[model samples]
Target chain A: MTDLKLALQEQAEDVDKVLDDLLLEPEGPEAQVVKAMRYSALGGGKRVRPFLVMASSRLFGVSEASALRVAAALEMVHCYSLIHDDLPAMDDDDLRRGRPTCHIEYDEATAILAGDALLTLAFEVLADEETHPSPSVRCALVSELAKASGMNGMVGGQMIDLMAETRELGIPEITRLQRLKTGALIVFACKAGAILGKAKDIKMQALRNYGHDLGLAFQIADDLLDVEASEEETGKKVGKDAERGKATFVSLLGVERAREQAHMLSEQACRHLDVFDRDTELLRAMAQYVVNRRS
Target chain B: MTDLKLALQEQAEDVDKVLDDLLLEPEGPEAQVVKAMRYSALGGGKRVRPFLVMASSRLFGVSEASALRVAAALEMVHCYSLIHDDLPAMDDDDLRRGRPTCHIEYDEATAILAGDALLTLAFEVLADEETHPSPSVRCALVSELAKASGMNGMVGGQMIDLMAETRELGIPEITRLQRLKTGALIVFACKAGAILGKAKDIKMQALRNYGHDLGLAFQIADDLLDVEASEEETGKKVGKDAERGKATFVSLLGVERAREQAHMLSEQACRHLDVFDRDTELLRAMAQYVVNRRS
Candidate 1:
């Protein structure tokens, strides 16, 4: 296996352990919600976002424990979003990662409560002193993550995507939507290391730029996979975007053009890592991997 | 009007203005979600939670601006819960605060996103430096609020409540459910003032004790109202508990006995304020008002 693949696997396992330790089973009538939380959160996925956090934090020499806590928190938010998005009132999906969605596995109300609890837990984890010795750094992390996931970012992007099902979106509109939906969280993950290390503005900017390009490339690649890959390969239903008439990067730009654009963006993303003199090979490889992967 | 009534009215108006200013209308495809958030958050309610926050903060001489921000954040979380709980898969309510619920006013998808955004915004507001000068204090506020609202608190209580629809619950079970659902947030509201003021442990304990009794009284009052009050008076569908055969305080205890319990709890709640020789007339009056309130 390639070094990048091995590192990603290791980071994913490390984050999974942190999440497991943080989310303890509750003994109560409401244990159902906690069970649902564990079901969705501990279910295996690529953990790409957590890997970015670990890789970015590694660049700044952040402690493994601290980075892992932040990664776990990020994963919690991601899992919560997925749970809510899969509800009957939203995307209404039955399957995620080849398993029943939270609402399908548990009842809808339980899934909703679990999602709400998980989101709340993410903030709680970030605010805890165990996440970082410095309160200011923790507050910064909380604020950044909240902003990235809140109305002006991921949630807002999802709102747009929901609306886009009825309307045709051009390339620029699709790009903006994807940026807000997935790109904001990616940018926050990359910049989290800088906040943890108290890196200078220039370094933070470099990571931000790298994350921006990489996130776009990643989304484009996802769009391509939805068109080219089967449900077995993707571990999710494919061609839902086309079925819904949703405008994605691939739908706006033809398959060949979208693939070319993703490749170009991946290369451009790697160029931003030049600002860091050492220990960025993992991030560089990640950019290539994100665009090249089938899923 | 009585002094407590006057104070509650004034505080409610203050919180409304703060929430309005904080939640600005967005200009984009996602504006629908923002509009839904505003509709639900700005919709007229008693704003009792914000009033509790203001009253508690007044005990510590906390800055009004800081207190207002915290109060607004608390209200946002409350509003988010209401929105999500009223969804088709949950409580399935069409009306809230004398108007259509968020999902009824907007699409279900939009309401869900708006709720998610509002919850995210709550943490963002608390973590902002404007909420507190010290980052540690902000972190504390975030942690406390998250704990109060997350699983094992409000959300857990909700899970239990949902489960109780199919199962019979005794007085003890009902009391525990109410404590987690509504009592935890009220306790946090009261304790938030102590945290902001950096009050002594004894004082914090006094407020916590007061909040515990007061929250129980409030829920009992709500249950009584549901059983006795009209839909117009309550601004929501009455007898939902009985309609669904849901277990509640009123169901376990006779109506007259439940009312008596609420009144006793209110008086007991006020007794906790004896520790504060200062101006606690508002809190004392609030306790009485909570039990006697028709809606």
Candidate 2:
């Protein structure tokens, strides 16, 4: 495997370990929610968000331990969103990462509570003194993460997506939806390092720009994979977007054009790294890997 | 109306105004979630949590403006929990505060999104500089609120309640469940004033003790109301615990014994206020009003 692939796997494992240590088995009747939380959060997918957090933090010479905690927190938020989105009242999916979804594995109520608890835990983790020595930095982290995942961001995007199921959306509308849905969190991950290191304005802006292009490219690639990849390759059911008549980049731009756009965005995302003198080769490699991967 | 009743009404109106101003109508496609949030949060029943926050803050001479912001945040958390708990997979209630529950007024997906957004907004509000001048204090508020509402507190209590529906729970287990579920947040509300004022250790402990007894009394009162009150009086369905065969204080202890317990606890709760000579007459009146309330 390439260096980026190895680094990604290492970071994923590190984050899993942090999450495992943070979430303890319940000794009371409420064990069911904790079990559901574990089921959804542990031993899961690519951990792409955690990888971005770690890579970005590394650029600023942040301690690996601090970065891992933030990564774990971000992953918890991401996992909670997935668990809720897959509930019977929402996407109603039975499988995720080739395993039964939280609601399918546990019960719907437990799934809901688990998702709520995970989101709560994410904020708790960020607010804790262990995340940062400075209270101001911790507050900034909390504010940024909350904004990224809250009504104006991920949740708002999900609402729009749910309403758009029966309506036909144009390319600009689809782009806006994807940006809010996935781009916001990705931007937070990339900018988190700057906040942690107290980086200057120019450097912070560079990472933000990089994250913006990379997130769009990543989503476009995901759209392409949904159109072309099989369940075995993707570890998830494919073509559901088409079956549900969901408007995606692939559906709007065609396979060839969508792929070209993703590639162009990935290259543009790499150009943002020119502002940093340190080794950003791994980040550049990630941009290419995100667009090129089958899943 | 009595002094306590008048004070409660005034505080409720203040919290409603704050919540209304904070939650803006959406200008985008995601208006559905924002509408659901407003539906559940605005013009609701007695703002009990907000009242507790304001009353507690008053002990420390915390500014009403600052206290109101914290109260509004706590109410948002309470509202979010109600929205989620009333979902079909959970309590399955049709009515809340004399109107349809969030899911009944809106779609299930919108309700879930609204709940998620409300929870997120609670943290964002607490983290903002407007909530507190010191970042450390804001961080403390966030940490306390998160712990009170997360897996080991309210969410954990909810899980136990869900599981206990199929199992028999004794009085001790029930007390523990209630303490975790509802008592935690109440205690936080009471202690928030101390934290904001940076009260002395003895004073903080006294307030915490007061909160503990008062929360239990409040829960008992709620259980009694569920057994005795009408739909119109409570603004919700009555006798749900008995209908579901869920164990509660009223079910374990006879109605007469439960009422006696609440009265005893209320008196005991007021004794903890002896450490302060700052005209705690309102808090003493609140204790009596809580147990004697018809709804």
| Candidate number of the best DockQ | 1
For all predictions in the order shown, the interface RMSD in Å is 0.7, 0.6
| Candidate 2 CAPRI level | high
Worst 10 residues of 1 chain A by lDDT: A244-253
How high a TM-score does candidate 2 get?
0.99
With candidate 1 superimposed using the best TM-score fit, by how many Å does residue B54's alpha carbon deviate from the native?
A: 0.8
**Candidate number 2, chain A TM-score:** 0.99
State TM-scores per candidate: 0.99, 0.99
lDDT by residue for model 2 (B100-121), tens: 9999999899999999999999
lDDT of 1: 0.92
Candidate 1 regions exceeding 4 Å error are: none
For all candidates in order, the CA lDDT equals 0.92, 0.91
Q: What is the lDDT for B107 in model 2?
A: 82
> What lDDT tens digits, residue by residue, belong to model 1 across residues A1-295?
9998899898888998998998888787898888999999999998999999999999999998999999999999999999989988788898899898999888888998899999999999999999999999999999999999999999999999888888889998999998999999999989989999999999999999999999999999999998999888888888888888888888878999999999999999999999999999999999999998976
Give the Å shift of residue A104 in candidate 1: 0.9
